[model samples]
Target: MTKRLQLADIGSALIVLFCLVPFYWMIVSALRHPADQFATTPFPLPVSFQNLAAAFAERNGFGRALLNSLIVAGTTTLLTLAIGITTAYVIARVEFRFKNVVLAIIVATSMFPGVTLLIPLLKLFVGLDWINTYQALVLPSLSFGLPLTVFNLTAFFKQLPSELEDAAQVDGCSQWQAFRAVILPLAMPGVFTSGIITFIAAWNEFIIALSLTNDQKMRTAPVITALFTGQYKFDQPFGTQMAAGVAVTVPLVIGALLFQRRIVDGLTAGALK
Candidate 1:
């Protein structure tokens, strides 16, 4: 057993290192100059700040794109948490017909390819005259982020003690009052976990944002990155692209670092109980 356990630990460490190699490569590539990318022996180092500087100042307007991304992601995170928390509570605590079926449906939605819905969604946005607007961006984000949030939160909520609600009610609290005062507070870990997931999902989203927004002013970071790879330029501005990649990843890293404890707690809260 000890030998087997040692082998398993080694395997896990190898897997983690394999997963991290691409990220490390990206950091090295982002620092190297475009010319150096093709050099006989390219080492990982920033060729020049010029690449990042130029990428930031390029016509794609990553600054505005980043700001728009922040708005869209921030809004989606808040909305998903508010709606998902309630839906999760209902699903976890309420005994009703077709409950398992409903849960299955929610999980199934996450399995569908989001790309398949793009054209249809774009047409819907056009009918609503919402193309190129923030509404188009926000609605699509909510739809994609909600199902996962609800599923995760429902699992977490199932682990909570029913005695808390009963005690709150015994104190003359109504259902809403009990939920607001008791359930909501205790569900913070789940809430923050969901919010972090939603935020990261929105931040890294590429396809929907690319399809929905045309104006550079409305573009997101990923879409703007696409601008670098065009017909005329066989080679993208490698350094700039790397820097932009770094920029995009920073917020997600910070968010995860800040709420990592909640993430672990939320994901594990009900799994064993």
Candidate 2:
């Protein structure tokens, strides 16, 4: 048993190192002087903030892009969770016609390639004059976000003890009140999991944001980061790009660290049930 435990620890350490090496390289590159960015050394000899400064340079509009991502992603998470909570409650608790079909359809929508919907969505946004607006970004993201939210939350709700709702109702709580008061608290892990996933999806989404928003001012961090070109033509600015990558990655890392347990619980909630 001790030998097995040691092997497992070693394996886990290796896996974590494999995943983190690229991120560490990005940070090292981002902190290296632009002139020394291509040095084979894995560590920055003398750390510099120039790459970070360049990434957030006023002309690059990275700050605005970051704010735009926050607005769109935050709004998408909120809306998806609100609707998902109610929809999941009904699907989990209420018996309705074609219920399995409905759940399957919701899951199926998430499986559709997002790229295929871009052109039609772009045209629709154009018609509505929503181009370069928050709504344009949020609406298309919902297509993917809502389905997963519903699927996860539904599974979580199903795993919850029905006695909680029954007890709430016996205390004169309406169905809505029972759900809002009794069910929601118990389902928070699932909600956090779904919300974090939705937020990350919206934050990292590129093609749709690129296709919909023509203006740089409305661009999200992922879109702007992709378009990052250095001061001169054909200049890749690897250091600056690395800085942008680190900037874009920090919030996601922080969120995952904070809610990892909840995410794990949410994913495994209904597995036994």
The candidate that achieves the highest TM-score relative to the unseen native structure: 2
- Weakest 10 consecutive residues of candidate 2 by summed lDDT: 264-273
Query: Whose lDDT is greatest here?
Result: 2
User: Each prediction's Cα lDDT score?
Assistant: 0.82, 0.90
Alpha carbon lDDT of residue 57, candidate 1? 82
**CA lDDT, candidate 1, residue 225:** 75
lDDT of 2 by residue, 12-50 (tens): 999999999999999999999999989989789998999
Q: Looking at candidate 1, what is the lDDT of residue 19?
A: 82
Regions more than 4 Å wrong, model 2: none
Superposing every Cα of model 1 onto the true structure, what RMSD results?
A: 2.2
Error of 2 at 221 (Å): 0.3
The residue pairs found clashing in candidate 2 are none
